[model samples]
Target: MSEGLKRDYQLCEEIGRGRFGTVFRCFSPESGEFFACKSIDKRLLLDSIDRECLDKEAKIMQLVSGNPNVIQIIDVYEDDSYLHMVMDLCDSSDLYDRVSKRIFSETEAAAVMSPLMEAIEHCHRHGVAHRDIKPDNILFDGRNRLKLSDFGSADCFSDGRSMRGIVGTPYYVAPEVISGRDYNEKVDVWSAGVILYIMLAGIPPFYGESAADIFEAVLRANLRFPTRIFHSVSPAAKDLLRRMLCKDVSRRFSVEQVLRHPWITSGAEGRRDQ
Candidate 1:
């Protein structure tokens, strides 16, 4: 740890690792509280683009800090060799881990997804788009409240303009992203829909043996709710999924629209609004 960081917090054991940094549990003497510190080695940032991504992650986290469903970055420190970010410590398992351990009923899945949609809506309202919205990015704090983390692949967008690049995990990636076309915030809705599918079905809506095959499936955008697996799933839930996983971006449900859907509004109780 750098001298400035050492003076501020006592770094403890390693808890996680990401593409460019290692996350450690740290203690802040000033507040007598624990936080997760992501220490990114300066050497790994080889170009301006790399440095910009790091800066963007910090700014995006700050941009959406007010949302309770989103992780808040408390402080940031830089030194000769590393960039350190201190943020909320979510020691519990991520959404992926929890879902993998058990199957979720429609109601249970809705309970988990409501706050996540709120988090995504919060990000969208702030003109930010989380390019990556995978299960691993969804975390739970000590209180078990859902908190969305990992802004490394997030970016800001404006109306009438679009973002370029295919940036997302294969299973949850939006079809528009795979098509190499300029996409907007709706891509996130597609990913969130995938999460909903996985939560209820215990499997991804799209599948393949390899990344390429998965990409092909995503490009095909043939969404189906297997009767065997989805027989017990609600029609309202399936309807929402069809709207969310729609290949036509114009027809896909927006985050706000999703929040207001009957399935969502009814608390996903396997019933639709009258």
Candidate 2:
């Protein structure tokens, strides 16, 4: 709100833009550290309920800070026209950028997935569900370490309470979410499974021509694994994917279960990046 605060940050340039807001690369004169400043327009928040959602996101980030695998929210300030959030600067591109380039090897995939799984496990332990666990939300740090970002769609889970509202990217939405059924942390596991499938196979198991079609496919479609992509993909990986992506929320594996899966534990030793 004060010019002192504004003057402290040297706005470098725009690094990314998305539906919610624009992210600017900035430097703090006091600490001499770089950060990403995400500015959300108050005007846009007026028309939508996302203002409260954004506030929730800020709180979630504050709760999750100090976890090495999660992005750190350094500061939060709001003015009459905008809400500004300062976060740790991650120079490496997102998983989406990497996946678009080519299918990642099992080693590379495991390298990324290890930290990601840890971060999700941390969130679950703290009663938070990311609700949106897609490639785009998985960012890479300057050291190439994977850090989960964008808590805009995250929600806290209390026992027996179901979140009402359609959230998350279309392709990553869980079956329960699509069916308007009561759901919880398991929904995040489903979305993570979809992400795993993409990382290993280079494509989503479900597809459709429209949003409605995608919703239908997510609800009723059987997950298909492409055996042709990687001849060496183990049965353990396929089985883990099946367990995570199961349409029945009750049947889906928990974050802890998924982390202990053979593909994740046994393969951890052999799967580090070269």
Candidate lDDT (C-alpha), each: 0.91, 0.83
Q: Highest TM-score among the candidates is held by which one?
A: 1
TM-score of each: 0.96, 0.92
Q: What lDDT is obtained when candidate 2 is compared to the true structure?
A: 0.83
Residue-by-residue lDDT tens digits, candidate 2, 131-158: 9899989998898878899998899886
Q: State residue 58's C-alpha deviation in candidate 2, in Å.
A: 1.0
RMSD of each: 2.1, 2.4
| TM-score quality measure for candidate 1 | 0.96
Off by over 4 Å in 2: 1-4, 268-274
Superposition error at 168 for model 2 (Å): 1.1
Residue-level lDDT tens digits of model 1 in 154-262: 9889666789998989999998898899899999999999999999889999999999999999999999988888888878899999999999999999999999999
Cα lDDT for residue 59, candidate 1: 88
lDDT of 1 at 84: 94
